[model samples]
Target: MSYNFKTIRPVMPAKDMINVILSKTQRKTPTVVHPGYDISRIRGFYMRKVKFTQETIHEKIDAILQDFPKLDDIHPFYADLINVLYDKDHYKLALGHVHACRNVIDNIAKDYCRLLKYGDSLYRCKMLKRAALGRMCTTLKKLTSSLNYLDEVRKHLSRMPAINPFERTLLVTGFPNVGKSSFVNNITNANLDVQPYPFTTQNLYVGHTDYNFVRWQVIDTPGVLDHSLSERNPIEMQAITALAHLKACIMFFLDISETCSYSIDQQIALFKDLKPLFKNKPLLLVMTKIDIKKFEQLDPIDQQKLQDVIQSENVFYSQLSNKSGEGIAQVKEKACGLLNEWRQNLKPEQLTGGNPNLLREESILQGVYIAQPKRVNQNRMPVIPQVIGKLNRPTLKDVQEQNGGAGVFSFPLQEHFLLENPDWKYDAVPEIMDGKNIGDFVDADILQRLEELEKEEEMMDQAEIEDPEEDAREEMLLNTRDQINKKREMIKEEHHMKMKQQVKLHRPNLEDAKEDFAKKGIDTTFLEQRAQKFAAKKVLQKQKRQQQSSDDSDDNDMDIEGNDRNQRKGRDALSRSRSRLREISRSRSRGNKKVLTAQEQAMERMSKKIQRRRRNEAKAGDGDTKIDCKMPKHLFTGKSGIGKQSRR
Candidate 1:
């Protein structure tokens, strides 16, 4: 439950904070801007500065806010202690102001950046940037008082001692100068200032000591005066806070000798006044400076008064003198023992922060369970030795150090052997004898046990041979299983063959079709007759097409020869009529004898037009060999850096 407040970062004044943030922004962002550059670029330049400034301011403020502990989130002891030293309201307000300033800075940056996008000129953007930063700085300046207060609190908190409120604690408190600090200095290494003046220990001091191998925290609080809670000073309130909140044993120190400027009656009255705060807590009435004045030396009335308080309060009473160190150990033991007993008696709900729901949760109760025997027996009790003490023999570590340290001294391993004969502890036996391991015969009854096992195996074999009915039944079941397996395999093979036939595409020949139809017991005569007619009809159509094609080819050859002669004659003539020239050109222009239909000719013309258009635009085709720009200006012209080799 204790927190290390020393790790909280130091808070800076508003002026220093502004200077640091501004300088950081200047260093991190671009420093130059020009009107000649693109307007977008100019706007971006100033926008970056404003945004960076805002972010730096937010980071600094946020760090301060997070570093300080929230009073409500900590233990009540520390929460009240902080409230006593620094007013709770002021602490919260200071942190709140810092938080609010961060939000304002963020808003300023957001608004200015939006306006910068519309900035028409570089000067306008620069002004908006300046305005944003100035507004943020002004907001921070307003927090000067809060910041200063936080800075002072941070310094004081860093010096405060870390006290764990949940641990076994012994809280020492009473009027000042009653040997409370003296008792702590004697028991622990607290080394507190023990002057003979009241209120010498002005703040809470913590020290640690161990009992039963468990660490215990001892806290020395400033003395509390017998007055109303409202009238108590900050110093006294610290002690009161510890007394009110911590689950520890309260050790009320009383100076019965009257050397601390408080009478027995007054000290007892103060104890009674603070008794309400000790409800359900372990209380110890420690009488210090007993060397000066023993309890029995007091007046009979004073003794009776002390006895009465002890009885009424139900508290433990003890006396100690720091000067002579009398009863100091006894006091520590009694306080620690009482605190431990109180902690043990606490309920499950009390241990889990008083949350009853947590008790029902399996995770919380995972380690807590009652282990009970199914049936209790008298012999189940654990055995305990009559005498338990350290052995007289030296340990291995002690013997090793005495000889020549670890490496030079080696302990005999055989000395620890538990044998029937002590003198035979160092006797050695051969690992193997006559090709057989000596360990195999180490047991004296090994041969007899092996003979018994062999006889048992022989009897088991004879018993199996005697069961004729069981053997016959097993044979019959195995034969039935074999028949069932064969039938399952045959069914699987047939299913696979059917699946393959369904997926394959096959055009069976006439012989194959005849054989397949015969297997299916269907008539094949009609199918054969229809197939003969189909073949005869196909032959007649093929012959007709061949005869037609031959006639057309013969006529085409005669026309081509006549056209060639005309073309030769026209070439020989010096000049020919336009009609004669046109006929010759048309005959020679026909490359294929088979003529295209009207629609086909139109489609060809459209395709040619499309090709021409593509050629004009220099479009690449699938087969065209294209080489990319080898020296693109943007990529190759500038210095090669990361991500500059490719435009993508």
Candidate 2:
């Protein structure tokens, strides 16, 4: 039954297909290489991809040995790393492989290293006109040049795209287990067991089915492994046919698992192999099981890792759990939206014109030919076949930002990548400044800078309240180095004088003392001077402190010199008064009362001194008068001029 293009019909919810895929899982895993990149561990200034286990090691070592039958020198460590990557789950296994590869790269570099080691020496010898050695040197230069070439190769390998999506024709991609029936399963869902254990969905699957309203066809394609692409599988013919004969888009999916069964590196490899085919298409990686980690622990750091991997902001992630229909509505909505979007943009006029395809509506017949026979007829016009597998004009990946062509943009995206994904603490794109990953940026780092700005603003407040003594101490720090240098010179002079007394034998160099402190990351502005002074000023300080420490030393000296005679007289008076009192008691017994007690005489003397001091203070105050209005006559009119006038 053909329906006219009135409205895009809704397709089955993603859940129905996901359910089929889940049911198929019990069909044992296919035999596949256990990718080492995900299992390895590494600790450094930077994060790295994981690697294989000991099982992988056995396979790789055996493969490498077979690949390079002539190479005799293999490090013993590779054997250990191989075992770890293939069999060991000790997180260090992945790290071991990374180090092993680095070791291999290093070993490969040794030839160049040895040649360059004597480069300066060889050049010098050549300059001195030594004929026999010069020829040897010329040959050495050839060897060095070859070594340099290997160095370039190593650099290229290091930067290797990890994904090699060259000019390949097709990609059979879909999320994990989407009932994405293989090419043969076009009639029924892909349920048959084909590949060995682990890699169960082995053979590349491709199938074509026509969309009723659009007159175009959709091809069902298999999924590409995540992480990295592998070229180990045998080619599928139907998949190749769709690639060569018809333009196709492979839909990639993920089953119900949050983490991939495959390593990230392996998945990347698989993507790479398929990338070039989708040259201009959106490399849309859809997440079907959105509900798996929906309520699970979404740690900020872990989510940040996810964000870094998937550069796109729209979380192409959504779950389609067949058990409970959570993401089915969103999935259906998205599918219909995509299909409708692709349909509205197509021009009946351009159809079978810009694109070259095998089948077409018979109306545009005159100028069109079936297929490119010679693979390069380099002529004739193009034809857009009936609606091809989910084609979108200006796909989301191709959309450019409006203000400037700065980034890939699509307005349909709900969350901004900056908000959705956590960024590295450091620079998103780092420059290797001082041979370090200046790329690692932190939010706290920026926050700290903001804090510094705030602190700077508040510094004046602190400055106003600063203790004058501490300010003086900080000010002292400015000249500390100068003082230290001066003291150092004095110490040197003392040493010289001390040396003068001895016969002129050898003396230790100044370098011996300079090695006392660490120069790495310490801030020594406050400590350096005190450290030096601890030895320099002790003797003089000790003597002065000792003198100051003796309590009443000055008073004792004053007593000896009779400078304290007034104090002594007061004390004598008090003693005499007590004696007089005792004498008075004795006198009373003897009935003698002629003289007054010494206490009364001393009290009168003390009162007279107090009264005299008060009188002197009063006289001093009365002698000075403060006049506000007039200047003194002698000052105002010169006294000498007045005296001359009187004389005249």
Candidate with maximal lDDT = 1
How far in Å is the alpha carbon of 332 misplaced in model 2?
Answer: 5.1
* Residue pair clashes in candidate 1: none
TM-score of 2: 0.23
Tens digits of per-residue lDDT, candidate 1, 75-101, equal 878888889899999999989988888
lDDT (10s digit) by residue, model 2, range 1-648: 111211222222223322332233223222222323222211110011011111222343334323321212322222222222232243233334333543443343333333333433433322221232223223323333333333333343233112111111123354335434332243224344544234445443323323322222333433444333234223232233233333233344543243546533454445455555544332345443345554244566545645564664332344454335555555434443444344335443332332233114423433355474675757869776656645645654455545345454436443334553444323344457665564464455787899899989798788678588988888899789789999999999999887755578666543433343233332344355665677578877887788766734665656544666656877998999999998867745577554544665676798888679658755445355645548776777744654464210
Off by over 4 Å in 2: 1-197, 203-230, 236-246, 255-260, 263-273, 290-292, 295-299, 308-317, 322-333, 343-648
Model 2 alpha-carbon miss at residue 486, Å:
99
Cα lDDT over the full model 1: 0.85
lDDT of 2 at 205: 34
lDDT of 1 at 502: 52
Please provide TM-scores, in order, for all candidate models, with all chains considered together: 0.55, 0.23
Runs off by more than 4 Å, candidate 1: 348-648
